[model samples]
Structure formats: C-alpha cells, structure tokens
Target: METQNLGSSPDVRSKNESVKSVDRRNFLRSAGMTTVAGAVFLAGCDKDDDMTPTPTSVDLGSGDVGILNYAYALEQLEAAFYTQVVATPFSGITDAERSMLTDIRDHEIIHRDFLKAALGNNAIAGLEVNFSSIDFTSRASVLGAAKLFEDTGVQAYNGAGNLIKDANYLLIAGKIVSVEARHAAAIRDLLMPNSTSFAGDDIIDAKGLDKAVKPADILAAVKPYVKTTITASNLPTS
Candidate 1:
C-alpha cells in the first residue's frame, strides 16, 4: 500500500528539466518543428485493476491525442497483466510480491483511466489482450512478462514525449514514466534476486538514460498480445 503513492516520492516528483529540455528541443529541431528554448516539465500526480474487455481494434488517431491513445493502449495491457497476476497469482508468490504487484495493478488502472479522461472522445477504443503466451501459474513467466511490459511502457512514454506538443501531456507522461520505472525496478529485482538487471545495458544507455522507442517498434513488440492492427503511420516522427 505504501508503494501506491510511488509517483509522489521525492525521486519521481523532482523534475529533470535540464536534461529533458535539451532532448525535447533537439527532438523538435530534428523533426523540423518549432522550438521552445527552455521547455518546462509538467509535474502532476492516483487506483483499481480493470480486467474487462475493451474494444479489440482501435486506431491511435493522430497528434497529441493520438500519443495519449498510444499510452492508453500500453496502460490497458499493463493493467490487465497485473490484474491477472494478482487474480491468479503464480505459484510460490510471496506476500511481498502480491502486495507490490497489487499496488502496481492499481497504478496501471489509474493510468488507463487518467488517459481516458484526458483524451475523452479523442481516445481510442479499449484494447482486448491475449495472454495465452504467458504461463500465469509460473512465477518466472509472470515476472518475465511484467518486466517486458514495464520496461517497454517506460520506453514508450519516453519516445512518445517528443511527439506530444502539449506541455500538459508531456508533464503527465513524465509522471507516469517515473512510476513505470519503479515497476520495472521492482519486477526486475524479483526476477533476478540481488542482480542489477533493473537498469542493465540492454534497456538503459551508457549515459544512464532509458532508450526511447518508436511507436512502430512499440506496436510490434506488443502486436502478438492484441489481435488488432495498430495503425500508427500518422503519429509524429523524430
């Protein structure tokens, strides 16, 4: 329950304005778009696990709203993941594991709802997911899948930030990504006890920044889970 407010923690609440400003400005210029010299980071900071079936196939529209849809899709997947993980907990799951994952599930659901409220009608349909690939009863399988989702979700938010021109959306993305990072770390520790796989070179760079993934790449990674064809061709580039 304590981790429920992970985003509000001092580490996550603090702004990385200097780093983000340079990256965002560079991204804008590279994309041949306008620029905001010193871009300010938004800092705004929430529960429940949703396992309901949302829309199967939905278009991620375009513009800032589309980016929101992109995030919503990931949140949909994550919320479902932790929901199932908690609902049908894996064998040998520790009480600590369940508590932490339950908190994560609540965070994801809150994220999904946040995006929905933010996007309103502009939001895409709720995604229907297929979890047949995962062995819900196996701790290894569950934690592995959780790691993938959390890490990818973090990267997705990082990449999608450049596409978002709205300061409000950018701020929200920052808030969510920090929590995702927390999830990634917690799950990673569970998977490899006392190991440093949380921020391993595979995901983070030498500079210690999480890699940003393109929308196309992100859709590909989660494609097998969702039966729909995610069309992100119109999303902003760079």
Candidate 2:
C-alpha cells in the first residue's frame, strides 16, 4: 500500500532531493560509527546506576534527518529478524503463521526503504545483525521474539514522537506507529486468544495517550539483536 501524504512542504522535499544522489558507502564513512567509542568514554561513566550507557554520538545529521535515521535503524533490525524467521520457518509453524510473518517482513522492508528514501544521504548504513541467541527452530521462541519486536517498535515510536519538530515528519511517524501497533496487536492475539495487545496499559494511559519509551530503554531492549551500537545523541531532545 502506498504511504499517505502528511502534507509536508516543498522545502522539505527540496532538501531531501539534494542529498538523494549521495552514495551509501560515502555516507557511512562520513557518519563514522566506528570512532564513536572515544566519545562514549568522554560522556562520563556513572557506575552507580543500572542504566545503559548512552552512545557518545549518533552519526546521522540532526533535525528531520536524524529522526529518519532513527526509524531506519529500527526498521533494519525488524526486517533482519523477520527475514531470518521466514528463511528457517520454525518447527510446527502453521501456514497462517508463515504467511503473517511474511507480510510483516514485507512491511518492515517497505518501512526501511521509505525511511532511507526520506532521509537521502543522511541515512545510516545498514548495521550487521546477530540473531544467534534466538532459537529459530522453536515456534515458542520465535513467537516470543516477535512479540518483543512489535512491542518495542510501538513504544519506540510513541516515545520519540514528541522529539519530532517538523509537523510533516510527525505525521509520517504517526502513520507508521499506527501500523506497528496493528502488527503488535495481531501478533499478541495470535499468541493469546481473546487478548488485545494494546489492552490493559500495553500502549495507552488513562487519558488514552500512547505510552512513550525513552531511547535508553529501547536501546537496551534491542541491544541483544544488534552488534553495532547506535547512538541517539543527534536525535531531537524536545
């Protein structure tokens, strides 16, 4: 399905076009994720707290570009996980299960590509994923992992929405998060009958606003699947 227009202005479109021609390799080299270790150290180490240490720097440019790259990083992770699931087809997985997963895989790929296109040269290079911890041969294990991914995607978008400054970008994020929430609900219902994933504070509060997960919380949850560290320092703070 085609993405709905958020009514972004011509200026944003012009800026996106300017960076579209840049090669991915050059963009990666310039972003310099490898050299981020030094900056991490400089950020100071507070050993007393249990909080995950924040990365020293994020390579993607600030503003709208940084937000797109943030989404891209998540899409890459989700796409990789689903790709592995479809490739191996965990034992005892029903045809329906396989088909649903395949649809999710396609959706994640589309989301990843759309974010890359939106960000142009400011997009981060696809990071290598390590899914060795997952027992792809087991249906229970696979479904559990899927639940975690969907939940994370939903909360991540919820938490990051306020950080978006541009109305157009916020509109895009809202659209994507709605889709992610649907994916989460479907996966949840499949695992547990008569249960909506978003029910009972899974995603909403008493006021009916979506729950927001801070970047640090999300990074910690996704750390096991990702080998390369992603820095969120460049993302909008507001």
Candidate 3:
C-alpha cells in the first residue's frame, strides 16, 4: 500500500490542497479556524457534552462535530479499501484501470487525512476495517466494492447536509460530496464502460438528483465492510 504524496502534481491538487502547498500538515495549519470557511469548530470538552464512546461502540458526537466525525469514519474506510485495491491490483488489470484506481486511492487518502486534520482531537479513533469479503484478486469483486463505497459516500454527505448548522461546515461537506460523487461515477464507468450506468436510474431520481440517504441507513448498509461498532445515538436527527 504505497500511496503517493498529495504534492505529486499540480493538476491532482484537492480542494483543501488548493489553499496552500500540498503538505498535509501545512494545509492543516493554514486551515486552522480562519481559513476552513471561517468556522471555528467546538474546542474543549463540556459538562453538557453527550459524546462518549463506550467499550462496545464508538459514539459520533452531536451537531456539526458529529457530522464531521461521521464523514471522517467513512473516508477512513474508503481510503483503506482503495489502498488495498492499488496495493494488490486484481488479476488482468489494465493500465488505465490501474492508473485511475491509484489516483482514486490518493484522493481518498487526502480526504481521510483532511478530515482527521480538521477534527484534531475531536476526531474518532482510526477505524478497523474488514475486507475479508472482498476478493482483491478479482476485478469484479474489487470494482463492485469500490462502486458500493463511492455511491454510499456521496449519499451520506448529501443526507447530512441539512443537519449541519455551520455554513462553513456545510460548504466543506458540499465540496467533499461533489468529489465523492465523481468517485462514484468513475467507479461506475469502470464497472460498465461506455454505458449509462454512471448516472443510472437506480441512484438518480426522476428529478435528476442523486439519492440522499440517512446516516443510520448509510451506516447499516456499510456495516458488513466495517468491523467497528459505531453508535450514532447522539447525532442530530433533524
């Protein structure tokens, strides 16, 4: 699992990377409170805070913080998946597929790192994933899992949008969701080349909008791929 640095090239820069140099730490420092859409995330614990992880389950905090943690968790899973995909490329993988998958792995790594940096101490622990079900040696297995993860990620962000109180956080979520959607499309295209599956009717509504799934539903859908017991009991419902 050899991932490339975010500074590999100028064109491959991500939304957060565009702020300054591609150094991950530098990006976090540059973004500190002032630049991340001007929203200062909650710092320090409080007596009224209800976010506490039990021995059995990881609790995603409430409000905007919870939403950020939720996003971070998903990115961790995707990053790990892509890392494995690129590290042990499926048999008979084409050069184009290899290149595209590698690029995707980088993007996912950036996403995971960015969220971890932004959350600082408030971020959740590194998630332990279970990819035992996926056969990395088979292109269909790998690509199918990729498609599921990407599509779920896009829907997760979209559904969490209205629950976010901070406009800055909402804006950032929008940016990330757009990237996730692109990833979803890319994976879909790879699975079914030169076809309408990229924007198929299954994911898109009659109004041409992508599906927006609730956090609980999204988590349940991805439970098979994740080993950690994540509890969102405190996450915002409205």
Best by lDDT: 3
Worst 10 residues of 2 by lDDT: 1-10
lDDT of 2 by residue, 107-215 (tens): 6766776676667557677676878878999766777788788888988998888888889888878777877776776665555533444354655678987667876
RMSDs, each prediction?
Answer: 12.1, 16.5, 10.1
Estimate, for each residue in 119-216, the C-alpha lDDT of model 3 and write its tens digit: 87798877778899989998778888888898899989989999999998888888778767777876675566446988988789899999899999
Q: Estimate every model's Cα lDDT from 0 to 1.
A: 0.71, 0.67, 0.74
**Looking at candidate 2, what is the lDDT of residue 57?**
34
How well does candidate 3 match the true structure in TM-score terms? 0.77
Candidate 1, residue 8: how far the Cα is off, in Å = 31
Pairs that collide, model 2: none
Clashes of 1: 0
Provide the clashing-pair count of each candidate structure: 0, 0, 0
